[model samples]
Target: MIGFGLRLTLRGGREAAVRLVVTAAAVALGVGLILVTLAGINGVDAQNARYAWLNSGVTDATSPTAEPSPDPLWGMLGADIHDGARITRVDVAATGPRSPVPPGIPRLPGPGQYYASPALGALLDSVPAAELGARYPGRRVGTIGAAALPSPDSMIIIVGRTAEELARTPGAAKITSIATRSPGDCTGCRFGLNADVLGLILAVTSAALLFPMLIFIGTATRLSAARREQRFAAMRLVGATPRQVSVVSAVESTVAAAAGTVAGFGLFLLLRIPLADVPFTGEPFAPGDLSLTPVDVLLVAVGVPLAAAVAARIALRRVRISPLGVSRRITPRPPRAYRLIPLVLGVGELAYFVGRRPDTTNGQILAYISGILLMMAGLLIAGPWLTMAGSRIMARRARRPVTLIAARRLADDPRAGFRAVSGLVLALFVTSTAVGVMTTMIAERGVPDAGPAARGTLMVDLSRGEAERGAPEASGAPVPDRVLAGLRSAPGVRGVTVIHTNPLGTMVPVGRWHMEAGLVACEQFAGMPGFGRCAPGAVAASVPPHFGAFDTSASSAWSRTVWPAAAISAERLRDLPAQGVLVRTDGSRQAIERTRTALAAAFPDPRWPPTTVAEAGADAENARILAGFQQLAGVVTVVSLCIAGCSLAVSVVAGLNDRKRAFSLLRLAGVELGTLRRVVVLESTVPLLIAAVVAAGSGFLAARLFLEAQLQYALRPPGAGYYVMVGAGLAVSLGVIASTLPLLRRVTGPETARNE
Candidate 1:
């Protein structure tokens, strides 16, 4: 029986190679995304783990604060981050195995160190532990508490010869204490191995896998119903049980799925080299353990077949209405089932929307899922109506003989019409998503005005020594004064805000601290000369809605009793104030408390002291960092889009198989191959055009809401290019489909239809 089944499968598969190829490719595309996404998460997690290991495990470095200047890494090249190494200073209570402390008030194992000026400056500058010996003749060492500071907020303690010497090192060293770090911008070293990346990967990968599974099973069931009607009918005529027929159908699906998995795994291994280059941070690298584990292979091998079996079983339910009543076409179902589906889907969507408010994350997820289901259900329920409309529209433009015939076909079989439309579903979903994401990003935070075009420029103050090494002819690179002067004098130069952004704490008005967990963005001070509107009273607001969080009830500006009137963005601002607290760079609560203390300490001074802008353009260092981050985000988006394109390849091939018969008929009727190919291209282009329009509309609406709700309080409106992401996305989608045009000519000759 197995041998017979195998032989039957091969014979059937050869006849249906085109369909199988497309279906298998789609399956492979889906699987590849799964593996790549998993690998990416692993890579990010591993990198971050390495960073955390270096930061959290070390005793000499803990809860570091911002530096006045950049530091050298590994005692050689300059890096903006505080330490080339993680430094922690643990306070060991058990003095039994005590390591000797250098000369200080007491030889206690609590945090203390000996270091020179340069090394001390470097250590105190950022979160990573500074190179102590580089500054002083003696090496600095210390112990920290078991509880280390959170990443991005962890401070790099400077262990000079004496506490007084460390205090006199420059900025306040006491701020390095866990109680003093800021909550905002505190990624610390832990950011290098972000668990959130893994979470995101899992979420996206699930959708990626499930979506293809849906498409594959849907198309396969439909095709099986169409092509295998004769075979199933004959079996039914020969006294085959309905159950037996169902089993055969399930077996066929399993065979197709297994073949796809094998092909997919092979392709994954073959493409490992290029896939490794997808991540921006690493060199071209593949995982040493590239192959799937036996368990993973088994899960895939079993799970896919089971999914196919389930789909086949469901489809077979419709086939069992009357096993003996066989026909070439299914009689139309009563409108009850078709109409009821829309109502159920619509009500489910409405219920989801109403039950879950858009103001919460749960609500947002509900809204998104509900929206997708409702749209799909509406499309399916209204398929015939849509087809009628499309046919009419095409009929009006069907001056050409071929287009007239195509329109007639569309008007006759709405099911087949939708198959022509299915190609656009993925394109539209991805394009809409891409547009929405990019538009929101662009509108909320305008592109960097690289030149009237330049948004702002930062003047970094390089150490005089480093500057001298770079340019011996120039005097001390006291960049704050020179760069400021140059920027002010340059044409097309707008306003300037010498603000600071780091994974560190800043003083705020309230006594409590808040965390700026993701990143720190410092822009022009409000009302700075040539900059946009900024009042001394206006503060930078980083509210919750800006971070893609659903809550938007928080006030755009807050009044800090300590700082008087200042606006600040919450690392996680929400409608619920009690749930919200003051934030710091490291996402630690201490920064808020410290902010209050700092504000109280510096109150009534003419200039806001602690958080005030230093000399003009002193924040050039921060500008460089923000630029680097933006660049990285852009690179990652481009790479992911490329991955998405590969999925489209599978989609296009599937679409081609559905149209092969029609194309072959056209060829037999003496239509030129080139014209047939163009028609195929035209078929793809039309749907994509419609999808582009829809996606653009969706993106613009979303962007508008995002900008108004989240960004307008702090930034200006977006530029023209901000809206252009849709066009760009459509172009890329079309380009992918266009590349597959050659397949249309495969059936152009006279023998094409006979083979079928």
Candidate 2:
């Protein structure tokens, strides 16, 4: 029976070929996107491990025990690289350069001479290499290899000299104790599910993408199902059994899917090249990072065709392949209102959580998780019901023949209409949720602070306190007052402000507070609401004081406890006891460079180096982490969207032939072409419009509830432009149905109308 099925499909020739190609193309695209996602994950994880090892200041052959004894390698082995105060991760490898470098970067700094990578070299380009010796402590000769890196766009700097000459110089960034000696070649050694939060993020993201893949496959499999049903019904009239017909349908879908999956793999490989160049997870991918893993390959090879077969079987179960059944218009029972139970449950969960004080109790966590699950499940469960309801209402209100025809078809099998958009609804819902949560988190917590440094002010924290917090591999310690005094006397002799801890490690007092709180010094009233008073010596608090709970008992809690306060500034930080110092330098870049040099030169030894901050990338961990999630969401959304788009296109084309007879009869009965076009357009546009509206509203509500539950009451919704973009994308997707309108002309021609 299956062999017979295959022959019948193949014998259908050009018509069969076209259907198979469309189905295959849809499958190929879905599978390809999934593969690309896998590559991204692998690349990010690989880069993380590489950077981790780089920051540990260790490499394969570096002897760990060899210390300051004369034979020492004085160059930096692996060091925590930074851009301004914020760490850019990007490693600095102190190894012999095998690849040639640009003429701009000098030879491995001979003890004091420094050469920069192309990226680093660009930053130092403004300063003359000869003049750099005084402030930078190294004469930059040239830049590192312009093309050596796997991610040519990476900011890797490799600078070192021959063993004998390098040994002469000492104490630069000597590779200290090795943290990891194992080379990162073994895939088995990599972190897996044990990554916890990271793992959950990837798994959930992958699952999100997988849904659209399935939707695409399912939609493509059912394409032309109406025509297939009719053909099989004719077969049934010739004494073919139901079982044989089922086997034929399965065989047909499976062949197309298997071919598509293979093509998809090739497409993925082609795409990986461009995707690798894209900066994601804070870095561009290494050469092989975007390639599929063995497991991913195996899964694609086996799973895609199998899924196709299963989907085909499922599509068949909806309609009987018999002459009598096919001749009769059979309407399946409309999905009931009860189908909305999951959505209702999800909303209830959200309400429960949103009403309570945000806390991390076990119950609260459970509620959050339950809410997420229920929301997703609810969309799936409610989709068909919503489709049916809309169809019924549209049919009821239909006064024209074209509208009536579209409505009746939809009302008959709303499941088919829902199938086209289920993936899109889920994608939008999840993406909006993530964006909303991030906005809330960012708004509530504010940005990670590195004390106060006004723009155009050169801030140098000689204490190394800020660097130590973010950069684990930093060896620099606190600098003494004498060095700071030297920095103040440097050529850029603009007044320098410094903060010092008393011998007791406590922040020095600026002055007594003059506000109602009687707080002494600006430190005591940090970020206090409604307080704009500057402290003595112009010093202020680095972090705002946490005002206690809002109590309604006192003064009826009518008046606000505090009002918005002026932010701490460099002026306010002038005379405070500080662990760090902020400098007000002239606008000249040379002056800034001179100040940085003076700060570094102030440190007689590398042990207690003074660090200078120009501009931090606002690239703190929270922001970076959130950005990663956003990037993932963006990737998944785009892929899901493409798959959804294809699914709809295939869906419309598949059903066009099925509606030919109805359209022909309607045309015969005096329906206008414009009215028929309107019907074709409405059939798809209305359901999609419903999906977009529902998804946007539901996703927003769910995200809002989550934000409230998390204690982030200051809700910052994603940009209003998100809706505009979504609407535009939806409009484009819905336009695909327009292509089917041309087919209407042929199907409803006088010849076809008379034949039907």
The most accurate candidate by TM-score is 2
- TM-score each candidate: 0.54, 0.73
How many backbone collisions does model 1 have?
64
lDDT of model number 1: 0.41
**Candidate 2: tens digits of C-alpha lDDT, residues 307-409:** 7677767776744544667668767888999999999899888888666744655466577767877888889789888988898898899887777878987
Q: Poorest 10 consecutive residues of model 1 by lDDT?
A: 72-81
**Which prediction has the highest lDDT against the true structure?**
2
Error of 1 at 602 (Å): 23
Per-residue lDDT of 231 in model 1 = 69
lDDT of each: 0.41, 0.58
